[model samples]
Target: MDSTALDLGEDNSLLLVDDDEAFLRRLAKAMEKRGFAVETAGSVAAGQAIATGRPPAYAVVDLRLEDGNGLDVVETLRARRPESRIVVLTGYGAIATAVAAVKIGATDYLAKPADATDVTNALLARTDTLPPPPENPMSADRVRWEHIQRVYELCDRNVSETARRLSMHRRTLQRILAKRSPR
Candidate 1:
């Protein structure tokens, strides 16, 4: 209708996945009206199937699905179709989850209920900076901390075996423990 709208037409192909049937249909139609060649899937399995068959240029994945977490779908799509940009959406979005998504492989993360324009911008903006996704946002440090905390609870704060199981020197584990304890 306007020049800006006309300019937005070129990048359109998208694969949209959500568990809510009505929401999925409405989004599909809205994206279509905006010139996207949109495909809709109501479950993770269906979305994975569609992606494997004919991968789109981008994807919009909800955080939770009827069958499973949408992160699994995102992982599958990222593995099978690396070129496809991914934008993760969640109705229960939090800072940690949003950061994790972005750090993992998402081009962008949105808090639903996101409008059609919100979705489009995220999918389209994938081109601006193509950073390689981190191998794991939950880094070894974080994992070690969690493991130590778990072992500490199980072993009643025993420092020896936790360090052994964690495959680190007792001194190193103690240093980590010191950080965790109150100063």
Candidate 2:
């Protein structure tokens, strides 16, 4: 898929799907600066609509969205364009989710807070080559903390619910939440 560098012309189009408004806007602007004609959608429905009508050559989709799972949009894009390069981003990264995304035709599965450059590289890199490691990869502890925070937020910030969901002691979850994140 990465036989060529970043494509130009109409096929240099990119679709970005994410529920985070600020992140979407920032990524759109950055990709546009990188010479892609970018379109964005904030929900799975909207993303699916755009993909069905005109699947772009490149795409960056979040694993979870307010309306639905972003993989639905990924499937839509693949149905329309098997050659499209798709990258899935998620804050709650898990091996099962990554495997599912890849099976459904994702080019790469990246954890949230992925640098725009990393996304671009994933979008353009050849499938046959090993990608360079991210310059600022998250530490294992940081990834764990981020996953916990995401689960905590999804549980509506209820300590007990978060703890139950995470299978951790309520007091331990509280202590972890109370402290600053690890570097």
Least well predicted 10-residue stretch by lDDT in candidate 1: 1-10
What total of clashing residue pairs does each candidate reach?
Answer: 0, 0
Off by over 4 Å in 1: 1-11, 126-183
Q: Using alpha carbons, what is the TM-score of model 2? A: 0.91
Question: Relative to the true structure, how large is the alpha-carbon lDDT of every model?
Answer: 0.77, 0.90
Full-model lDDT, candidate 1: 0.77
The TM-score values for the models, in the order shown, are 0.62, 0.91
Q: Give candidate 2 regions above 4 Å deviation.
A: 1-10
| Index of the highest-TM-score prediction | 2
**Cα lDDT tens digits for candidate 1, 62-130:** 988879888877877877778678999987667888887776678889876677877776776645675
lDDT of 2 by residue, 28-70 (tens): 9888878888999999999999999988999999999999999
Q: Which candidate is the best by lDDT?
A: 2
Clashing pairs in 2: none
